[model samples]
Target: MPTRPLTCTQCQPKLLAYVHNQLADSDRRRVARHLNDCPVCYAAYLAQREVAQELAGTIPSIGLPDSLQLNRMWLAIQSDMNRPRTIPRPQLARMGVACLVFVLALLLPWSLDKQQVALAVPPPPRAPVVTASLNVTASPESGRRALPPTAAASSTEAVIPAAKTPDTPSNVQDTR
Candidate 1:
């Protein structure tokens, strides 16, 4: 069929490479005699052989693992490909700050500080607690006379006008 017959626009592009036998034997005999005389290239070669038999039964293959689950997945990938390789958190914090600066440079000359460290002497000033309150005058016939802290701190001043503050509502009465 080759010597030149093709056309349902060249056998609709050689019907999916002639339904996967990838064409060549002289363009698969001119696309199998133009899919035996073109009913639209034989319904485009039965829709490219039902999409190459639904893509060769849509994939799903991987089945191997049985020898005791392939020897426990090859002993978990050969113990994760033979272990030991850690050290890197910035080289383990620069080897713990170079072993704390080589144990503080070998205890810096036996912790040197030959002189300066005797600061502990503060204990003297404590005397001002002089609380004196006197001018006691409430006297329903002298029922309460008590005012003597050296006569209420050597008394003298006396003009009481208005001093109230327990949130302001006391029976205030020193009208002088």
Candidate 2:
């Protein structure tokens, strides 16, 4: 894709990426070119570089591991180096057994639950039918006021007014 040239806004964010050499070849080149052309972005890049340098200088150095620990690590490394690339027969067998046991553990309960299933649960009894009279003296601006808030909240037979059809006379307001 033909990317648009980087503006100050775009270049500002990538200064850190440019400073750290984290930008891709094309992106790095673009950012480097932008830095040269734009003094403001170049200043930002310089600031980022300075901050990186300061951080590098102040980082507390870690002391090397002790000789015994180093020797143990070397021995472990050497042992791994001498070992065959493919899995050993005995270890592979043990791993296979472990995986089989895990699969059985997972599947056993599911299989048992399926075969020895409990009686099916019955659905709850249907809700009692409710009837209430609602006086909806509502306008478009006022909206519908079907009974007081307390009465409407408990009632199940709350009726929503249907939209006006084109056949309805404009003079006769729908009370439904």
Provide TM-scores for the models: 0.21, 0.35
Error of 2 at 18 (Å): 0.9
Worst 10 residues of 1 by lDDT: 114-123
TM value for model 2: 0.35
Alpha carbon lDDT of each predicted model? 0.66, 0.70
The reply for model 2, stretches above 4 Å from the true place, is 1-3, 60-176
86-155: candidate 2 lDDT, tens digit per residue: 8568988999999999999998866754212321222234444466555554455666554443324343
lDDT of 2: 0.70
User: Model 1, residue 23: what's the lDDT?
Assistant: 64
Which RMSD values do the candidates have, in order? 19.5, 32.4
Q: What RMSD does model 1 have?
A: 19.5
